[model samples]
Target: MRSLRKFLYWLNIVGMIAYLIVCGYFQMTGKPLYPGQVGLMFQVASGLVLVSIPLIIEKWAHVALPDILVVLYELFILMAILLGTGMQAYSIPNWDKFEHLFSAGMLAGSGFMIYAARTPADKQDQIDPFLIALFGAAFGVLLGVCWEFYEFTGDSLFGMNMQRYMAAGKPLIGHPVLYDTMGDLLSDFIGSAGMSLYAFFKIRRDHSWLNTFKLHRIK
Candidate 1:
């Protein structure tokens, strides 16, 4: 598992670097880059920084994140930046919605880990499992809203149309304008609820399972 995790981590980095070079070439050659392509370039660049955050925290704070969580994080970046954006997979119907759902589920799991890590070790098992599940679901939904906010801001400032507020160079109106954002939120909620339900049952069955997902402090 450790070897698999390392392999995936490096693979994502290489993918991001390759995308960056391609984007740079287009820019240098005065070629027109579509909005999605530009967004992909920016996201891939940002991913390099985002992926390093866990290692930085582990090194400086002595809080070691679980290897599975790290692997999932890297995989999410790969899917979103490389496959979804770089490969134009978003052009597929419902692909964006699928990404939102996947992201929410992953975030929900991270929420569970966060709740467990913040609790006192002695009291962890004593805490209500339902509360942990609720926290996970709520955290996922909260972040989903934040993501929508990001898209809205990007569209408002840069005309990125990230929220699908525009079509064919014309601004959408009424229900159509809200469709993409609402669908994304609904998908996110469903994903969060599904993960929370699973967590609740799993925690009730074996409290020790949560330990595998929690961050550990280095001695």
Candidate 2:
């Protein structure tokens, strides 16, 4: 078991490094970065976190819940950048649906992470799972806000407008709002909240009534 866990841990690290290489190559070649780029890095960080799982198994892990929260915040920021860039790239082809799906995944992943992190060492039910879910939803909205700001910056810098046909032409203002940046933001929240609720029910199903009560009623 130990060897297998260690192998999985290192394998995750190698996968992350490989992803970084691909992303760097794309950036160097002036390829437009996509929605999953930052997510790939986020997975790398998550993998690095997993590398400590062996220590965590031995109860020598140094990371605290707040530290984990900070990392989660960073993950959300990177995901927002990725999602916004994808939106910018595909805003012309009416392919914002893919962008929405990406945003949804970001929100959902954050929600699951929050709940998983809160699970106690001994219990199947996570501590304050609802609160963790709330945290995830709030961060989703926070990421959405930052994404909108990024979109505005892109508009200002690259002269890319979402309103009208904005790409590959002489950059101009008064684009016809081809995409709903705000709508994407709301969709992010929806996805996050939905996943959180799903996890909540899953916990309720997998554990005993006594354990559930312990999570809710214990000190």
Please provide, for model 1 over 111-208, each residue's C-alpha lDDT reduced to its tens digit, 9 standing for 90 to 100.
Answer: 98888778877887897889888999999999999999999999888879899988899998888999999999998999898888988998988877
lDDT for residue 22 in candidate 1, whole number 0-100? 80
Over all chains combined, what TM-score does candidate 2 have?
0.42
Tens-digit lDDT track of model 2 for 14-132: 64566567776786677835655565555555555654543463354433322222333333333333322322334455355345544554555454454454656465444555664
lDDT of the candidates, in the order given: 0.82, 0.50
Measured by TM-score, the strongest candidate is 1
> Per-residue lDDT for 25 in model 1?
87
> Which residue pairs clash in candidate 1?
none
Q: Which candidate should be chosen as best, given lDDT against the real structure?
A: 1
- Model 2 residue 182 CA deviation (Å) reads 1.9
| Candidate 2 lDDT score at position 101 | 42
Candidate 2 whole-model C-alpha lDDT, 0 to 1: 0.50
C-alpha TM-scores of all predictions? 0.81, 0.42
